[model samples]
Target: MVEIDESHTSLPVLAFFRSPQAGRSWVTAAGLVLDTANLLFSALDVPRSRQVELTFTAGCLAVNRVQRFFDKKAETQPTELRTPEEVAAANPGREAFAKVWQELRDGGLPVRPDEEAAWQHYQALRMRYAPSIEFLSQLLLAPAMGSLH
Candidate 1:
């Protein structure tokens, strides 16, 4: 599991895939999160902020690359939505993250530790934004659509 350091404000984001198959899974999961967030934000009348756009684009690119990999594997299936619990359960290539962190701790890695810390920050931000996302999704899909104003 990728462990977040509580003392740090940033969360470390790591992508690990020894095989192309695992890579696809990571990409798909990330893409789903970003896409869902985007739709929910837009529905809630949230402006297209630069951070949101960048996140959305990164998700889409990941999805696209994963799709290409799936094509190579001759697999076909629609994207699936996964909950945070499911994501954690998958144990998706987190060891790579640990290795990178270890290297940084040993002063062998060139990347600044702060850059890795950003992942923790992102996670915190995600939690804060989740309520907004849910509210927007519900507001957009309400049956009467009369109380949104």
Candidate 2:
């Protein structure tokens, strides 16, 4: 088991270790919705760019659905935020996000030159909108948690 050394870790990374169950559930739900959209898009003869747009829309819808489900659940059952250590104990999504981040850093995740600007803009907006550690975790870990075994 890998022990997270919080002293050396940034706040954003530590945030992923905070809500394992919610993170996993939200991610799985979003992945299901996105996968459905992907299948539907593949069957149609839409242009590649249009397909990408629709996929993005599908992802947004997934987030909204997850938020709604959890919000209602929250009303009936309050949840306390877990500490980083507690969350990391059973959370695989944190490590998965770390691996993906490393892959991006090593240039393993590539974007075409034509799309580089759009990618950068999207990243900037992501950071802008994710104003807190918890918010950042939801955005980063959801997809990762959904994909994990």
Model 2 C-alpha lDDT per residue in residues 8-126, reported as the tens digit of each score: 12232332344444545433443444433432333223344676555556455434433333345333222435455534532324354344334444654442333334334434433
Best by TM-score: 2
Report, for every candidate in turn, its global Cα lDDT versus the true structure: 0.36, 0.37
RMSD of each: 18.3, 13.7
Clashing pairs counted in every model: 8, 0
Deviation (Å) of 137 in candidate 2: 9.9
TM-score of each: 0.30, 0.32
- True-vs-predicted CA distance for residue 97, candidate 1, Å: 35
**lDDT of candidate model 2 versus the reference:** 0.37
